[model samples]
Target: MKKVEVIQDFPEVELVGRKLGPFKEGEEVEMRPWEASVLEERDFVRPVRDFSLTGVRKALIREEKSSRLEELPSSFYRTVSREVRRLREGGEVEKAEELEEAIESLVDFRIQKLARMIISSVDLGDIPAEEQVLANFLSQPLTVWEGSIGRVFEKNIDKEVGVHAKKVRRNI
Candidate 1:
């Protein structure tokens, strides 16, 4: 869900079998993301909270200064990606490039931190939902790897116990 402000007054609009609103010009309302996107494309609404390049820059700075992965809003990546695409579409190429670079750097930092967390089996306490999903995916392989190693260790232990028993029987 996203909050969007109506930009023009309109009667109830039926969309995809749902009736949306009798919106006034200044009205702010919560809508499904798809609904907001549709209205925004028609110039009927705009996002109430837009993520900006400055916010991304600040987040990158914070990530650089921290040892742990910095938490971000759940919509962070989605908004940033949309903003970058919007900039490119609007012919703000230089700004879009800069924003993309910052985002890549931030992602690199977080990936390193996530790798450490997965290796150490640490809790993903405050990461954004997107990163949490990624971490969950990556951790599945780690779980399998750990189980495989445990089986190898158990086999070696059994071999050692069998060797000891054979020596004991020969002595007896």
Candidate 2:
């Protein structure tokens, strides 16, 4: 289950023998992913990323970055980024700041993980299944996913080819 904020009013919904809310716009609620998916498909709600743990969140980001073998859904990161900005502008400055920091940390962690994956995939001859996936992800031109973190990944990959790679490699 995860937290999601309603973006539109919805009548009460029953699921698993329990009644959920007649949710209003801007209302936050806990929901199972399957249930949330129904609302999300209609653009009625957005998932709230858990940003409570700096280290754990950063690690998760690293794992996600390294495991990608294909493109993500179009709205995946954009929705989270938009929600963070919304929270920041809606008077939740402290929480927004925390989420923003987590996002930055996640980006950094991802860069480091990609750098390591590049090195291992190129130099180690044969690597793990996940590393192969990372390698495949990197094989695509970053421009294929315009306006996304693919640009950051591309920049990091370029850097990893030189002295900066040495620095990023150490972190991984």
Best by lDDT: 1
lDDT of 1 by residue, 60-149 (tens): 889899998777867788889999999999999999999999889889999999989998988879777789898999999988988898
| Candidate 2, RMSD to the unseen true structure | 14.3
TM-score of each: 0.60, 0.37
lDDT of each: 0.85, 0.64
Flag clash pairs in model 1. none
- Candidate 1: regions farther than 4 A off: 1-50, 160-172
Off by over 4 Å in 2: 54-172
Candidate 1 lDDT score at position 12 = 96
List RMSD in Å for every model shown. 11.0, 14.3
> Per-residue CA lDDT of candidate 2, range 57-84, in tens?
6545555666542222334356557767
Which is the leading candidate under TM-score? 1
